[model samples]
Target: MRSEEEVFALLIGFAKSDERIRLVSLEGSRANPAIADDEFKDYDIAFFVTDMESFLSKDDWLDFLGKRLILQKPEDMELYPPQLGNKFSYLMLFEDGIKIDLTLVPISELQSCLKRSDGLLKILLDKDNTVKEEIVATDQHYWMTKPTAQKFTDCCNEFWWVSTYVAKGLARQEFLFAQDHLNQIVRPTLLLMMSWKIGAEKGSSFSLGKNYKFIQHYLAAEEWELLLQTFQGSGYSETWEALFLCQKLFRTISKKVALAYGYDYPNYDERVTPYVQGLHTKCS
Candidate 1:
């Protein structure tokens, strides 16, 4: 297995040696200073090049990286529409357990690239000096922002309102519908509330990392255990348990957020909870 430094050196060396590739930049976790360094962090690299299509035409060029366990070129594929917009990528995992997600972009698109970037970026090489300033990686973009009163109320309303859809789906025996409501709609707001609680505990200024991954830092041991329990959804029985846990977690987090920030939590006991309990009885 190549060391992280060795892999990074090779990536930079490759970019420096190629004239078509005028600049190189690193993004994602490697660029995020808040994230604890680990071997599993992927090398999210982008090469600012002269001609993206010229590089895409060749298959053997990528052999220099490593023996690919599997590779996915998103722009080259026909099934899913590409969101990259003028950028091409190689999502490659090497046989030696190293993964590198490399993207190719035309140098002409640098203006737009800077605007869309998540603010965690590091320049590795630049032959033309297209970048005017030094880049420092930070997780500032993923920080838990102080929510406005409207935003807080909206989050609470969304969590309590969408939850009824889960109850409706479960009563109708539409497991897929229930799963979507719980997973896609309600869960994100629950996660957001969790982040706000963490932010409140930590002076309302620190980041919770991407998707609130650092939330466990502020959570009590029993709360974290309960949060973990919410992820178990093997069957209908487990789905009910998961929904119940979501309600419990959301109630706990929202009250903390409301008290800290002067927001209002929905009346779960008088409204959604009993309605859901009745739906569960009817469905059973």
Candidate 2:
């Protein structure tokens, strides 16, 4: 494993030597001061260059860095579809265990990059000073914003209402569909409500990070355990247990959010409880 200083020095040195590469900016956890540095943290780097074609045309250019275990060129592929305009990316895992997500964007698209940037940006090399404004790399992009009245009501509605889909899927013995609705659609709303509670506890100005990864740091022991239980899916029995656990956790978290935020819990919780109980009885 290469030291952070060595890896970073190599990155900047590469950019500095290449005339095609004008500006280099780093993003993600590596650029976040709040996050502790670790080997697992990717060197999320972007190089603002002149011609994207010459670089995209060759794979050997990557060999200049080091031996890579695997790499992904997003813009070059058709399957996932590219979101970044005039930008090519190489998500690389080196043979030595270093992971670097390197992107090459035309300097012309620098404005667009800044617009979409999550603010966790640091300019490593700005030869021509192509970057117009200074970037303040904060986690502001993922902040637990004070939800609008409609957003609050909508989340409450979604969490309680979509739960019936899980009940229906379970009754039909469609475990995958049940788990999908329960875990994907319904669970996110529950997580949002939980974040709202955290925001209330601390301040609404802070972020919980994406997928509520940092939520456990703020959540109570029982809450964390219940949340963990909500992920219990492997076989049919496990899926059923997970669905039930999800229900319990959702009810607990949503009630707190409803009370704190003055949002109404929808009436569907009453309908789904018996429906799920009946299915459990039938399955037994």
- What TM-score against the true fold does each predicted structure earn? 0.95, 0.93
Q: What residue runs in model 2 are displaced by over 4 Å at the alpha carbon?
A: none
Model 1 poorest 10 in a row by lDDT: 261-270
Per-residue lDDT of 72-180 in model 2, one digit per residue for the tens? 9887787888887767899999988999999998998888778878889999999987667777788777777766667877877787678777777877889889888
The clash tally of candidate 2 reads 0
Q: Write the per-residue lDDT of candidate 1 for residues 1-284, one digit (tens) a residue.
A: 89988998888888878889998999998888778898888999999999887898887888888799999988888898888988999999999999999999989998788878888898888898778977777767777778888888888888888989988887887889999989898888888888877778786655776666777888889888988888887777788889999999889888988999877666654588899889888877
Residue 198 of model 2, lDDT score: 82
lDDT per model, in order? 0.85, 0.82
C-alpha root-mean-square deviation, each candidate: 1.5, 1.7
**In candidate 2, how many Å is residue 100 off?**
0.6
* Model 2 residue 131 lDDT score: 67
Off by over 4 Å in 1: none
